[model samples]
Target chain A: MDPTDRETACFEAGVKFGALYHQFAGTPVSAKNADSLETAIEESIENQPGCSAVSVDIHTDKLETTRGYTELTGEYMDVTLRIEYADCIVHAEMEMEDGYPLMRVVDIVEE
Target chain B: MDPTDRETACFEAGVKFGALYHQFAGTPVSAKNADSLETAIEESIENQPGCSAVSVDIHTDKLETTRGYTELTGEYMDVTLRIEYADCIVHAEMEMEDGYPLMRVVDIVEE
Candidate 1:
C-alpha cells in the first residue's frame, strides 16, 4: 500500500526516501483517521527540500492507535523519526545517536 | 563491529537509536580512518537528545570512499540522513519524503 511512482522517480533524481511505521492490532482502523494521519505526514515531508518518499501504513486496523517511526534517506543524510500515537495525540522523537549520515537505506536494501 | 552495551542501555532508557552505513569495498579500510570516523559518529550521536545508538561500519575498504545514510529513531519521529563521501569530502542529504515517524527499526527487526 506504500511506494509510488512519484516517490521512485524522486529517488532516481537523488530525492531520497522515507516511510511511516505500522503496527497490527488485529482490528481495522477508522478510515477517516487513517486518511488524516496519512495526509498530515505526506504534506509535512513533501514540504521539506530533498525529501523524496513519504508513506504511511496502519499496524492493525483494530489496534485503534499505532506506534512507530518514519524513515528518511537523502543523498548525504539518513535517519529515523520515531512516532507514538494514542488518544489522537502524536509525539515525535529524533534518534541519531549513531552519528551523521549513518546507515543508508540503499545499503539496507542492497546489502 | 556495531551495537554496544551502553548504547543498548540507552535504548532501554528510551533514548532511541541510529547507525551508520557501511559498504564492504573488498579491501580493509585504514585503522586510523576507521577509528576517526567511528569516534566522530559516536560522539555526535551521544550528544543529541533522545539519541541512544551510534554505530559505524565500512562498506568496502577497497572502494576508497563510501556512500550511505544515517538512521535516526526517536519516540515519535523516524527519518534517515543521507550521506555521500569521496576524496574525504562528505555530502549529506535529508530524505523525509513520506512523512513523520515513518518506520521503526523495531519493526524492521521483528517484522
Candidate 2:
C-alpha cells in the first residue's frame, strides 16, 4: 500500500531529525560552546523540508561547572525541541553522552 | 576535529536505524503480515555499513483478532531490534501508530 500524506510527512520529519541529532550529538558541550551548539541545531532543523519554525531547549550538567572544568569533563545534554512544520508539529527529545546523542525521538503530534 | 572511530560508527548506525524505521513503520501489520515486516527490517539493517547480524521482534495489538477483522483495523506495532555492527551493538525500539513509527531510537553500546 502507498503511504498517506501524513505518513510521508512524518517519515520525512524523522529523517530530518536523524540528521539533526547527529549534528548536535557529535559536538562537545561546555559553557563557552553552548551558543554555537544551539545555533547549529536551529540552522539544521530550520533547513528541513517542512520546518518553518524551530525552538530548542537544551539542559546540561556541564554548564554548571567552571569553564575550565567543563572543558575538561564535557557535558551530558538533554535536548527538547519543538518544530513547526507546514502540516504538523514535531516534538523531539534527545539524550547525549560524551557529546553524542545516544537516544532520541521525533514525533508528529496533535499538541 | 574529526569524529573518533566510535562516534563515526555510532553515527552511521543511527542513519541505518532511521532508514529502517521508515521502511518498517510505513507498512500495515497483522499476523499474516508480520514475517514480511521482520524480513524487511533485517535486510535493511544487515545492509548498513558495519552491520553483520540483525534481529527484530515485533508485538502488536491487531494480531489477536480474527484475520478478517485484522484486515479492517490495522495493528499498532512495537518493534525492538538488535543490530550487530563490526564495532558495536545497536539496539532500537520503535512505537508505531496506524502503521507508521512515531518514536524510536538506535543506540550503540558495549553490551
Candidate 3:
C-alpha cells in the first residue's frame, strides 16, 4: 500500500487498540491524563513478548473551551512503536470537544 | 535520498519557485487569492514543456489578528503539482501569523 494507506491502517489499529484498552480498563479513557495513557501503551508494547522497543515520537497539546468549562486535552501523539512482527509507527490521538471523548487512530506505518 | 530529504528538497524548490515567481510578477503573492494563485501555477506548469499535467491538490485558508487589526490569511495550501521532469508531487504551503508572511514549502514526493 501507499503511505496514505499505511497511515490509515495505523490509525485504525490505534483506534481498535484504544477501544480494547479502554474496555480492559473498564473506565473512560482520560483525556486529562494523556501522558499516563501514552506511558501505559509504551510499557505494554515494550514488555510484550518478542517486542523490540516502544517510544513516543510526538505528543501534542490541545485545549477546547465551552461556555462553562474548558478542557485541556491532547490533540495527537505521533508515536513510533516497535514490536516483534516489525516496527509499527502509530499516531494515537485523543480529543475532547463539546464534552465528548473523541479517540481516533490517526496513523500507522510498518517499516 | 529518503522521504524527509525529498520533502525538504521539494519545499526548497517550492520556496525558490515562489520567490522567483514573486520577483517576476513584481508583487507579493496574496494569500487571500489562493485559488487565483493556484490557477496561475496550474496554467504556468500546464503550458510548460515536459509537464504531463498540473493540478492543485489542496488549498487552505487562515486568519491572523494583531493588537488592532484582524487580518485574514491562509494557513497552508497542501498542493500536489506535477511537472514534466517526472511526476513531482509538491505541497505549496503558506501561513500568515503575527502579521508576517510565513510562506513555507512543507513537502514534496516524487513517485
Interface RMSD of 2: 12.4
DockQ values of all predictions: 0.03, 0.05, 0.01
Place model 1 in a CAPRI quality band: incorrect
RMSD of 1: 18.8
- Which residue pairs come into collision in candidate 2? none
- Chain A: TM-score in each model: 0.32, 0.60, 0.36
Better of 2 and 3 by lDDT: 2
* Every model's TM-score: 0.24, 0.40, 0.25
What lDDT tens digits, residue by residue, belong to model 1 across residues B7-109? 2222222222222211111223443455565456556644543343444443323333334322222211223321212211111222224553232221111
lDDT of 2 by residue, B1-111 (tens): 233333333334445555555444435566676677777768866765565656666564445555432431213555455545455555545555666554333455643
DockQ of 2: 0.05
lDDT assessment of candidate 1 = 0.29
Least accurate stretch of 10 residues (summed lDDT) in model 3 chain B?
B65-74
* Fnat: each model in turn: 0.00, 0.07, 0.00
Candidate 2, overall lDDT? Answer: 0.51
Off by over 4 Å in 3: A1-111, B1-12, B19-21, B24-42, B45-88
Error of 3 at A4 (Å): 18
User: What's the lDDT for residue B93 in model 1?
Assistant: 22
